[model samples]
Target: MKWLLACIAPVLLAAWILFLSAHGPASWVLLPGILIGIACAAGLSFLRSFSPALRALSLTLYLLPLGLLSTYRASAFSVSKDFELGALPLASAPSEMSIAQLPTGVTYRSAAFGYRGGSLFEPRVFSMTAILIKHPKGDLLIDAGFGRDIAQHLATLPLPFQLLTRYTLNKTAREQLQSSGYDLTRLRAIILTHSHWDHISGAADFPEVPVWIPPAERSFVQGEDVTTATARSIKSLHIEEYRFDARPYLGFAESHDVYGDGAVVIVPAPGHTPGSVIVFVTLADHKRYAFIGDLAWQLEGVTEQEERPLTQRIADFEPRLVREHLAHMAAISARYPELTLVVAHDPRSFASIPKWP
Candidate 1:
């Protein structure tokens, strides 16, 4: 019983706290439920001690279903396609432009956490990428990789898995930009799709560049400790609230035009997070790319249409809402064939693009 409590209590407590924090639920209601649950769990484990095999079976029954529930709930927003379709015509690789890739860092993770059928025997290795847009006006960084300080801070967070196992911040965005001959201070602006730590950790590096963030993201950041601080600290940053606009590249959607040109546009793509926006860039050559942050964490999410496993999905009190949004994103992507979608964490997409530095 003690061993069971030691194992299950921490996981449940962490999950519960994260749940409460994500949703502003009344703590009074949750506290008693958690306590009762813990008691019931411990009591049941004590009773099953007489049969070790039964205890193990009970544990598996309890956890496996919970994992499935979490995964389905987390993917409630994910879109399901009944038939397999070939790649769209516009989705073809660009023929005119040169592409480069910069490795931000390597994320380490258990095989169970990565691909759709990742097994303990098949360990998964992944890397984070930042694709640089070498524009005529200036260089635009798609996803800002972590700075030195923020990377170290994340290394110490009380997460079940090491961030380094999932992401590596090998080259800071600022350093890469500078080394590539682009002045850090002269950067035009940064468009962020969401406020996940991995996406926004480099915000501190470019203090003065105007950051264009989706309206919903601004609200989401208020609930997170580190990100809220980073959001508040970004100097000269511009919060682009959700607005109905009629622009050339943006068409009619909730979006913000950074330079009022068709060059860079921030469009709301809110399933990954409340305020998640897709940074759409039309290169000088007229090729378009959409940087969808965490909308799809892995390339297989796009190619194979595999939703994240239940154990790894975010639990924001009401898991159904999050799942529904993810499904919506998949549906939208399926409908749009004109834009090349870029998932922020997918190293393959990043590798296919040009690196800034």
Candidate 2:
């Protein structure tokens, strides 16, 4: 009876929290968590020395410390961040062509809590963004975002990840572009910030288009998966080797001008993924935008240098590198608040900004 009580309490608590933190935060989160917790408790109870108090205390220590530490760590991270407007250095320009920013489709809505640890426990709606760069030479799409069949991608995901992404797909990138009256055929190529499913799922919509991938991130997907199928079908993937140069600027050593013109440039911002990069778009109006690809899920993560919590980090390609990169990004943003840093999946940040010229 004592062991049974111990098992029940932890199962209920774990399930409740897991369910709430998921993207959809559905009641479905309860079942998996409860089952896992029960299995764990059963294994521990095999010990003859196990008692109710001991079991409860063990679970308490494990669960309580993780949450408390996450909150405390986020607070400490926020405290470490600060920047000045005058300290940002501007480098020499390479071209004078004007570019336009156009975003397609609705941002795929998600939650701010467990999906992104930087937002604390708040359950605010977030987005998976898809942006278009209209250049004189050709237009480029950054982060393909969601598609009509986003559920298929989510279903193929492993374990905790599959359970985490439970949000609805508002529309596909292609649907957004066509509805917005943009010429989809004119799209020169698709630029993937990284090969994450949400960002690449919609690539299937534009099969004939050329795709550009970062040198560092080309191997993000290791095994045979849906991402591979999408990538393999691309018309061509050029390293754009000549454009990729090892020059120090914008707190990064490597940068590339998309069109051999200074209108659009890709900069190394590794950490979120080893190959993750950011796009620096300087419009004809002189306004500059940095499209950060999952570097920080929320802008607050940049301001506070708070990463996506410990548990979330476990699933990341490289969490330590991610934290270091987050710190660097926050420092850059701090020094130049005027340099607009657009997060890929943050709807609030994307809302105030206009899409396409």
Candidate 3:
């Protein structure tokens, strides 16, 4: 009876946590349940009737799932082979064209949260950054980042997300632009990589500026999906929907060249969301960047081809589509070593871009 009790407690504990991770309610609600399991397991040590060997086995069983969850590798998907990408398109970027990064805030998390094989002890700072693309025609903001009303924005999220997420806000993208004495008139649109709250929150601050998105994303924002709750809550957004022409830029089947000069091209890579995109920006110096939004949370998603852990199913709308796009991007990175692939949440990916003064 003693051996059976010792063995069963840790096994039950691991199974309970795994079940909650997948199907539990809010993260806060999960805490009490998990703590109770821990307390029960800890209490079992007082059973001196169990042999020392039995106690050792119980401890090992309790920790095995945690170790696997943190470091288990997922099978990698293959890159698209049917599509052939020819020579890079010539970009007629204006001499005055430039780009900058506006870091609004960061969320502290373990590397394990971003991708599989990442260490739980290793801390990763997820950047809530927006990009500014200055053009002779009109300037564009890649994403909104955090906003002045971030507290309200956060409150709109699911309670589980709110409980698990810890963030620190700096200046919003709107505040940064205004403080820099930027000409608001030159701003054409806030081109969203996706309509997720973290990317669209600051757009509320610029009610007058139009928010450009692909048609699919417009539907997502207008739909009843819980993911776009924050975006739907912001009634002031001026939405301008656009479509993609059947022009293959890189391996992508369809592309929308925003500037018509091969300088700023938008390509659909909708796995993270129904309308997620990869924005390709070419500068006057011919430096190129591909701002991939949440396809992978970190550089390793492209470089090493690591996908998010299975437990983080909530992070992706369609995991299969994400893997397809990720494999596609990974192939592009390999073919064009000079082009920089910027993952939205990876701060290190923005090191080359200058920060807004």
Q: Tell me the spans in candidate 3 whose CA falls farther than 4 Å from its real position.
A: 1-74, 79-83
Q: TM-scores across all candidates?
A: 0.65, 0.76, 0.84
Colliding pairs, model 3 = 27-160
* Native-to-model Cα distance after best TM-score fit, residue 20 in candidate 3, in Å: 14
lDDT of 1 by residue, 234-271 (tens): 44345545453643233313456654555566666565
lDDT of 3 at 242: 88
lDDT of each: 0.53, 0.61, 0.82
Which of candidates 1 and 3 is the stronger one according to TM-score? 3
Model 2 Cα lDDT, one tens digit per residue, 1-357: 555555455555554454455453444555775675675566456435686667556566447424633442434543343323243334333344443334433322223442334333445555666777766576788878776656665566666656655565766778777777988778888787777767877776776676677656666554454434444433333333224688555666677876664667787766666677778776655677778877776676676566665454544566666666677767677666667877776676675466544
lDDT of 2: 0.61
* Model 1 TM-score, all chains together: 0.65
TM-score of 2: 0.76
lDDT of 3 by residue, 1-357 (tens): 556766766666655544433332345545766675775565476457666787777767767566556444555556555546567778999999999999999887666667766654456888999999999989999998999988899898888677666789999998898999998889999999999989999899999999999989998888988889999999999999989999999989899999999999999998888999999999989999999989998888777788777544676888888888888888788888788999999999999999986
